[model samples]
Target: MKAIFSWLNKPYYFNPKPLYKLKISIYHGLFIFLFLYIFRPFYLHEFDEIILPYTIGIGITAFVATFLILYLPALIFKDYFSEDNWTIGRNLLLMFVGVTFIGVALWYFGEIYKEPYNLRKINLLQFLSYTFLVSLIPLTFFVFLNEKNIRLRREKKVKEIRELKKVQELNNTEKLTKEVSITSENGKEKISFCIDNLVYVTSQGNYASFFIKKDDKINEKILRVTLAKIIAKLEKYPTIIRCHKSYIVNTNYITDISGNARGYLLKSKVIEIDIPVSRSFSKQSLLRLIS
Candidate 1:
């Protein structure tokens, strides 16, 4: 039971690629069509009197319903459906909602074809229950496939970061000798330091705070500048990269990285606090830190 709960809360992928969506939709439609033909539920066999039309109608309706349920909201709510916060439970919810919608569509279409010749037919509720039952296999299959994909991606990324860390460690010797300069937004205040001395930069509202490592101690220098404004200037120093909306960090100063599914938490040797690599920027930040 504990393991099941952990799996439910584990991170999962959503809003798959367009080609994958289309392929899945097609398979769903075909599965529905095949199930209908084999089971002949709700007097569908009687519809064999005019089988061609009903067959086409069922196939097309299933295809369109699956496509809309799976693809439309992804485009509309692109930012809301990020992989960082998506969980297995959320994905299951999405699948259940999709199955419900597909059931509703099929119920509506089946109503149209219910002829006076045969008044014997299942009600909407029963049809929907049937849909849910029929849908279980495919949804479960996808959950496993998607989880495997995430595991594969994480493994490859971890390997890439490991190799890059080795190269950067060697290059960091020269990087420590260079000096970096940053100025305030109004151009009134400025600070300069050797690359090794700077630990991280954080901003709140319009004030940016620079955390500097000196004599094995952490010191802070504040400047009246937004993080966005200061970030461009810091780019000249390759080790300094923005990891989140509120923070920029020197990758060379990062002592440990926690690979949480939501984001990467960075711990620095000189700084006591944990810096975050946000969902929106984690991929790019990792790329920057690695290369």
Candidate 2:
């Protein structure tokens, strides 16, 4: 029952789920109507004396029963379905059984209302068996739809994952100018940093900070991507200057560069950070910082 509801409620982005439910409900109602109408002659043969009234009552019951039969299991299993595959199968099974039960019930209702209503006279087992067989048509249809839904969901997920990977790859590619390798004393991890998107790299006691540009804004992420390894990575880019032992600056965004024996300054409207240029790299760093 839970599975049946889940299959029915599978998400469809463009078409709201309620609209789909309404569409399916109407179709089921019509299907039940046709099934009853087609078998009206057989019902009449057994209850000829009160056929008119019996037919009217059965029609009304069938109409209401069709939607109830479809909705009941949906309400019951509203939360039980968790897995996608099971949800699809359960929904189909519930609908199949619901329709079969309603059809058989309508048959019994017609017979019971007639003039010589002999409760013991009818073959209840045979009626149930026949109804079960008849329900296979709609059951098959529901199964087909369920399979299709699963395939579409899988495809959609695959597409979304592929797009996310591309975005991550592009971000990595843009930082290509900085080629820094990272190694941990724990020896569990080692990797390289691509410098294209790098805004700045900062050092902590035993860790490093990697600030990269994402959506035109800088976000600081800690990487085992060490400061020394990061310097090794940026070796190819001469413009990259070590401003401080603790800080490295991408000179591309440097607006003003000034320093004496104390430290160096780099300024932009959004940021102002001092770059400490060591005696060894001070000349080169100062030249890049100014240029």
What C-alpha lDDT do the candidate models reach, one value each? 0.75, 0.56
Candidate topping lDDT: 1
Superposed model 2: Cα runs more than 4 Å off:
1-23, 38-56, 81-86, 116-121, 149-291
Q: Which regions of candidate 1 fall more than 4 Å away from where they truly are? A: 16-27, 30-43, 71-80, 116-120, 160-169, 176-230, 242-248, 255-291
Collision count for each candidate, in order:
0, 12
Per-residue lDDT of 98-130 in model 1, one digit per residue for the tens?
888988998888777766445456788888887
The lDDT, on a scale of 0 to 1, for candidate 2 is: 0.56
Which candidate leads the pack in TM-score? Answer: 1
Instruction: Please write out the lDDT profile of model 2 over residues 130-239, one tens digit for every residue.
Output: 66666666576756665676556545543454454345422213334545655665667754555656666788767887666667777777656567767775767755
Model 2 residue 151 lDDT? 58
RMSD of 2: 20.6
Clashes of 1: 0
Cα error, residue 220 of model 2, in Å, equals 21
- On the 0 to 100 scale, the lDDT of residue 269 in model 2 is 38
Residue 39, candidate 2: C-alpha displacement in angstroms: 6.6
